[model samples]
Target: MSATRVLTLNVWGRGSAWRRRLPLIRDGLVRIAPDLVGLQEVWRKRSGCQAERIADGLGYHVTYGAASSRRGCATQGNALLTREPVARYDVLPLPVPDGVEPRSVLRAEVGATTVLVTHLTWEWEHASVRHQQVRFLADLTHLAERRGGRDVVLLADLNAAPDTDEIRWLTGRMADAWVSAGSGPGHTYTPANGFARKAREPARRIDFVLSAGPRAVHAELAFTTPVRARRRTAWPSDHFGVVCDLTSDPGAP
Candidate 1:
């Protein structure tokens, strides 16, 4: 079979900065022409929906899950876009600490592979939450196996660096795409907040694309100028996009 190109990005919110970054987002998508695209922190306000807009504009099918509880009528969460029709989709609620905001995993089936889109919490003190997230992903893998799925690709802004235990836990059963391809550590989270800018450190390699099966190949980061511009826009989010290519083996299970 042919290889599948996938792109995963975190579009902070539909803020003014996001508008500025949209052109770069559009251009990158046009250039890569990925088969699937996973998005985090997607906003769907009553007046407008960024996920739907992107899907419609790009001519891809879209599926999304709300991370937060319906407080009257606000919805925000993760989204998955695919050139192929989605066979099925669901949302997996994740553990969140008392003071932390809600988060969730959005799963969708594109052909034989299952793609999971997620955005981890920023509460560093709550290590337990991260552990729970890892367990949740493991459970999802098992669920896919039971459904006769051959592969699982998890992509997201994990909010944790590669050296952290949280990342290790999530990647325990999966191979990191970039690492497998021998690519250099591509830092994603740029300096956005005052503290981050003041430090003036290089970006952190927190965003990731991981695969549970061996079919993943040629996985690498997709850095764009829009991502840099968004980082400098004084926004709360400061993450770059991750892109990878997966080729299914003829004998894949």
Candidate 2:
């Protein structure tokens, strides 16, 4: 492939009318047709994993990392979906503060490409924790690239804005897709979405696609529109998804 399309989204776990939201997510994925997908806040149980369900019949292989459990049944975590069969996969537990929700990064190799998916600590006061997590991710990405002999694509709902120290540190080593190619503000978490209003977070771009080698050719926010239902408005997730196209030829543009 001359270019790879990568997408990242925080699926909001099993929260906020999950049953109704699943189809919307599946439909969005179909429309986007990304080669690689990174998802956070994915909930899974014996019935079936959320990522698997969404990827069903889509010809994508899924790898999930369980960060923590929800209630007594479902496991919550991050996931990576690839168009190619996975060559190898691993999960890294991120550093978390006491009494806080657990977080993890999932890595998968497809042919010569490596993809890493993660969800960082979300609280506004948890920047220090996110910093620790980013340091770990940075090192992991470097190691992966060295071993793979190719660029690594990182997808995440980082829960931190672009200017935050955690993101700044990562961007120093990688390229931010939105900054390179997105046309607008690219706010993934905003009160503009009725579902996101419950989070009380200021409008900001927290989702991302970063690459170690490829240059971003195009990018935009997705899953921002709501679907009309008889009883209520349905959105794909609490956060908007991000889609970016990347190319290895730096001189193409």
TM-score top scorer: 2
Candidate 1 residue 240 C-alpha distance from true site, Å: 1.3
Relative to the unseen true structure, what is the C-alpha lDDT of residue 105 in candidate 1, on a scale of 0 to 100? 94
CA RMSD (A), model 1: 3.7
RMSD each, Å: 3.7, 1.3
Pairs in steric clash, model 1: none
Off by over 4 Å in 1: 69-72, 191-202, 226-237, 250-253
All candidates' TM-scores?
Answer: 0.86, 0.96
lDDT of 2 at 93: 89
Question: Alpha carbon lDDT of residue 193, candidate 1?
Answer: 38
Prediction 1 global C-alpha lDDT: 0.75
The sequence of per-residue lDDT tens digits that candidate 2 reaches over residues 126-203 is 999999999998888889877757678889988899998889998999899988999888999999988999878789
Clashing pairs in 2: none
